[model samples]
Target: MSDINRVAVIGCGTIGMSWASLFLAHGLEVQAYDPAPGREAPLRDFIAVATTSIGRPVPADTTALRWCMELEDAVGNVEFVQENGPDAEDAKRTLLAAIDRLTPAHSVIATSTSSQIRSAITADCRHPERHIVAHPFNPPHLVPLVEILGGADWAVERSTALYRRLGRHPIVMRREMRGHIANRLTSALWREALFILQEGGASVADIDDAVRYGPGLRWAIMGPYLTYHLAGGPGGIRHFLDHLLPGHVKRWAELGTPVLDADLEAKIVQGVLEALGDRSIADCMRARDAMLVALASLSSAADDAQDDLRGDA
Candidate 1:
């Protein structure tokens, strides 16, 4: 991450714009580009709101941002490139190949594709070793997680360091895989939740609440693995794995495999609309950002209290 101050955001959609905003807030020079005309204003608007949402001071000067209409111009001298193209396989391969040709050999190229695997994305790249996946959660300006997969060790270290510099938690994968880490875990939960909804076992809002109020709150403290380790009490994980683990196998076997056919799709649409009630998308987004900030504060305070207790001990 040394001597790397300029980053090219190669697509001005939500993820690209949010990346540009976070970079700008961290005082990095951002060269933003999109094929569509008249995206500069929207990107600026998004950056302004996003910066506020994350409690970062709005970019005092927009001079640090360079809006580009051409791909080659954006990546010419950038130290890193974040491509946010549509999630099609051939399109991403073509776009990455073009960026690879234009960008300097030293710059790391990362895709913001949520599910596309590395082999497909880097198929046409002249230097696939530096090409990697850097998927950020939606509303990435607020979410601190960035999932990294598929890169040479050097490129991976640089990218991971860059994310840390921006105060993001980046998880590097030991193996290349589709859907990466977070998405795969969540998708399994979603499959069963949808199956339950379709079967009239739970309302959409109720299912959401089950996670949001229950496992989600616990997950924020420690993930499922550690939480279950505690469930074994004095015996800890060794005892749980040896004794209690078999009980979960039957539950896993009973999980549903749901298909989102037309009727189920319509049910989901109606249920979600009802759940949303009177809240607009903007309203929900604002509330979500606010809660994320509050949760971060809570975690920080909990860490401080734990440190104090350790000192007493």
Candidate 2:
């Protein structure tokens, strides 16, 4: 019943490969295109690893994946196109314009751009109405959040349904912004984190632990709003605003915006390297994915328990 069955992935980088793996896992035929020479082997390897990490077996049908050298060949017959090209404005604009010209009028083109706004990328395109931003978190196969912005009402609705079918949590923004919603929040926190490191308040490992073992754990279940609603005790969010809002404002004023100068950059690099210790990047990624899987399972179980309690009530 879904309008999207066959998808065209226009880049084979990490994000693109992850999207391909997810599409394949959902039994959708994927046509992939990348200009990099000898990319098929590495892409396949990445897909295999990502599938394992997400605990989804690849479809037995090898025919579901078709590698195309030309951009026109990739988007010719696909119902949806997911563009993972470079984040640069000019490059994305050119790529999107090409896709707009080649793809069918009804086929929606979603860009996996994290920072660039949809309007900017689609500015040169003839069919900007069908173009939209569908930014996914890192390792799209594991993360459920996909931030969607721009597009016509029909296109947005279609994309929402498609993403829901793929078992993704898609948020439709009312308007376009540089970093969308999630990335802006993350950037704010990251700025503060960098400031903390520069001021010698904490090491990289300590800062990471402060998040992972603290708010990050709760964030997996409920966002900051609901978390603070609970913090208001029995009186709820109203009480929270009355008592806690002033303190938050004061703290916000004191928050630092650290510049990533040479010294700070070196400190960060050294700190991260120290944190990694003997583990290679691959090893660290595998470990991170394993932890993510565990956390996802726990979150699911908790949700089910909460639903049961609600039903009993």
Candidate 3:
């Protein structure tokens, strides 16, 4: 039913491993090629952990998955290429150029880049039109939000269709911008959070708790706009705009503009380290991914409100 029966994951990092595992779970032939040596074992190990967490068992000797030493061998015949190369603009352009040269012309090349836009990365590629940013929220096997952007309509549509089949919620950015949509929103929140920390409004852990216990509960179901709309009761967002918007505007004017100096950076680093205390990175990732899987299971395709006259739900 799907045209994407085979996929080539062009990196063996956390993002690539997760993408490969998700593709493999959906019964696609996966040829994974990474520049690093002795990565096959770790990749397979991560996949095992990921699948077991999802309650899906991967076969020991399945020919559906292959490890290739050469990038050419990996991308030569695949229908899709998921590039999770280093986030540097130059490195990404070089890698994508190589993938574009090796992969079939009909194949779609999607970058898992968070910081770089498609135009910058695909600049060196011969067929730039086939490329798109399919940025996933960390640990792609569980977290299903994929921010996709591309020049070609066909490529974007196909990528969207493929992601939908993978049980991912793909949002196509109408225009190109660095950091895409989700990361931009995340950056705005992070900036405010850092400002709060700089001003000593709360301890690092308490700030996290405030979010996790308060607005996060509502955010788990709907975003800030929807929450505000509901806040307006019978009149919706229009009522909120007329009544409560002033308070928010005043608060926004008072929001701190934090500069990340050495001291501020250290404070954040040390604060996070203290908050993390006994938890290992592995422990944190495992737990976070498990929680994400559960949350995603409970999630529906909540409305974006773009078409909302009354409100699209």
- TM-score of every model versus the real structure: 0.94, 0.96, 0.93
lDDT tens digits by residue: candidate 1, 3-115: 67999998888789889888888888899999988999899888888777767766645688988878999999998999998888888989999999999998999899877
**What is the C-alpha lDDT profile of model 3 across 1-313, one tens digit per residue?**
3588999999999899999899888888899999999989998888877877766757857888899999999999988899998999999989999999998898999999888867878888889999988999888888888999885898998899999998888998888777888888888888999999999998788889898999989988888899999999999999999999999999999887798899999999899999999999989987888888778756642342444535635
Flag the better candidate by TM-score, 1 or 2: 2
Cα error, candidate 3, residue 92 (Å): 1.0
Clashing pairs in 2: none
- Give one digit per residue, the lDDT tens place, for model 2 in 217-303: 888889999999999999989999999989999999999999879999999999999988999998988888998888778877888
- Against the hidden true structure, what lDDT does model 3 obtain? 0.88
Task: Give the runs in model 2 whose Cα sits over 4 Å from its true position.
Answer: 59-61, 311-313
Considering every candidate listed, which one attains the maximal lDDT? 2
Show model 1 residue runs off by greater than 4 Å: 59-61, 301-313
Preferred candidate (TM-score higher): 1 or 3? 1
User: For model 2, how many clashes?
Assistant: 0
The superposed Cα distance between candidate 2 and the true structure at residue 68, in angstroms, equals: 0.8
